[model samples]
Target chain A: MPSSPSNQSYHHGSLRAALLSHAMELLDTKGIEGVSIRAVARLAGVAHSAPANHFPNKRSLMSALAARIFNQLENEVLAQMETTSGQRAERVMAFAEAVVAFALTYPHRYRLLWRRESLIDHDAELHSAMEAVYALLIGTIEGEDDEFTTSLETRAIAIWSMVHGYLIMRLDGNLMEKTDELTQAPRHRAIITALLEGIGGGPSGARRDC
Target chain B: MPSSPSNQSYHHGSLRAALLSHAMELLDTKGIEGVSIRAVARLAGVAHSAPANHFPNKRSLMSALAARIFNQLENEVLAQMETTSGQRAERVMAFAEAVVAFALTYPHRYRLLWRRESLIDHDAELHSAMEAVYALLIGTIEGEDDEFTTSLETRAIAIWSMVHGYLIMRLDGNLMEKTDELTQAPRHRAIITALLEGIGGGPSGARRDC
Candidate 1:
């Protein structure tokens, strides 16, 4: 076999993305504990020193990985929220769907993002990046005051906690095993509806229901 | 120092407690990854084979640890809930306090129990034991409702998810940073109040001042 390329052979422009891509792949196969800068460099077909140029340490690499994950999440949820204007029920459902969909497809990433708070002190920029994601959700629920109740902060926290909580429970399989009758979609819809109705008023006061 | 009696020569009850107590101490100091049967036995002044009789493998030992942790949590929460009679706000506040207290004081055990879902299929008894702890919370919440607006199944999933999510967020140090001004006490009260009022339309609605 031919000898592998040395540290000098690595291209600079794409090394960061390549490292993150390989790191996520390792996380998929071996969980978070398996991810390391050296391990990622090995998988990315680069020399060990190549990864060092992009990430000084594993923590820095992880912060970037987490930021990208949140960036993707923000885009997905923002897109879903765009589809449901003026309809409170639809808005809540879309927001909840965005959360559950992300959790189901990328359970590891979901867990990692939730754990970001533990690292806020370790990295200041990450706190703002994550806050941006939270702000997007809060904005979606902070729609203009109707003739009825109006408190954006309360509504935002209420909706966020409810949806976030449900996603965690479902991903952990707690909700799945505890309730046999309802699958994820229908249960999600019911929860979304109940929370909106409970917030704005019962069915009659809700902005949209179907 | 006096010569310590070896676990092999120790009485059965004392050895079992010794193993568990030593393991718990390790858990507090070093986290789950640091605690193992061998380490626990060593810390307990036992021979290598001493713990095998009490816990065949790591999984069983973890299960026993989780069960004992939840048993303590259940008793503490139930006692607090009992002290608060018919006042919904007081009852809810006590419940939230009990949860935060457990998580803050026993951060390791709280993480162990919440993260235990990852190991559900490892043992049947462990799974059922977790459900029973959840059932205690559901039963208490159901007791508060004069008439059910949401099904018991829905309520259980929703309530457990809210508290679990909150505890996870707090223990991971996420919510703590956000609520430094209010302290976790008021922030959790706000979340719990939103859940209660968000479920039913009444004077119980969360105060707009928040």
Candidate 2:
């Protein structure tokens, strides 16, 4: 009889990557709690023991997944910044658009990253990766010093808050009808303007007729 | 012989409240997935069947728990607002401080409220309670508005984003370290000032030297 694949010791060359891809799909369907080695292996069409060899336990799997997601986001932002040349406000907007697009495209993954309160602890790599993302944001804000304060950390927090909140609201369908009253580009610009100028500092950015 | 009273039906007169309370503690300790009606009943020192008489399912239990937390937050904010009277800027400062204080005091519960994306769709009562809290914030801003270009909903979103972002960063210990630079009163004032005036409109309320 021909050799059976199930009996083969080394079934696939990239079981780890396959497991993670299946895990992401499970997250989209069942959310964070739904992920497990057996579940992932089942989805990946592998024996149940296959994932145990890779992840061993749930915490290891979660940390690895979160690290991968943040790393991807970091690379995307860095690439966007490297190629873009514009005014400080323009770069800020481009960065914001890039972030929003990421969140929109992988809504479940973005939600999983923020859901790390339960999963993250003293892991230095995860901690530093999160901080690295924050630093990139602060770097983007460096260009806005002429228009705003140079406290990159504080301004970054303000911008992060606005963008994160907007993304969450949009994903939840809360921003649908109301945001239609104004074009998103101008609203985003006005918010970036507010972050740079303060609330009452700039020429009233609101349309007079609206 | 008489039946053992503890094991008998109706062992706890307030089994419903006890179950919810126990579930909240479990949520804090183990996050959402760790919470189960049977586990809550076990923690509450009641028969496992007792929780079913009240909640019937995990979804309903979670919904009830979220409602309780929201009600507590609503009461806290209203009580704090009642004690403060001032201009628009002062009122905004007071509100922000109350929000920060509340979130800091109950970090786990706060995360449960904010980080759980599925709650918005699963529970109508919970959703309405949340909207009511946002309305209170809108009323505070409306009291100070002279122009009213943006709708109350938009303004509420802006304010919530700022406070929510601040709380998230503060909890993660990602803020600048300059404790003595501004007293609580001034820090509160500065955030409100920046919100009202925009970045360059006036002093950011930060230490002028920085």
Candidate topping DockQ: 2
The DockQ-based CAPRI class assigned to model 1 is acceptable
Which model scores highest in lDDT? 1
Residue-level lDDT tens digits of model 1 in A31-93: 666777778988887767778887776677888877778888888888878877855556667
Alpha-carbon error at B142 in model 2, in Å?
0.9
Q: Which segments of model 1 are wrong by more than 4 Å?
A: A1-13, A34-38, A46-53, A116-120, A146-151, A199-210, B1-16, B36-38, B46-57, B87-93, B117-122, B143-149, B199-209
Question: Reference contacts recovered by each candidate, as fractions?
Answer: 0.22, 0.24
* Model 2 regions more than 4 Å off: A1-11, A79-84, A143-150, A173-194, A200-203, A206-210, B1-13, B28-34, B115-122, B146-151, B172-197, B200-206
Q: Compared with the true structure, what per-residue lDDT tens digits does model 2 show for residues A20-106?
A: 888888887887768777898897788888778887677667777877787878887788877777766667777776777788788
- Residues B79-112 of candidate 1 have per-residue lDDT tens digits of 8788777554466567667877888898887787
TM-score of each: 0.81, 0.81
TM-score for candidate 1 (chain B) = 0.80
- How far is each candidate from the true structure, as Cα RMSD in Å? 5.0, 5.1
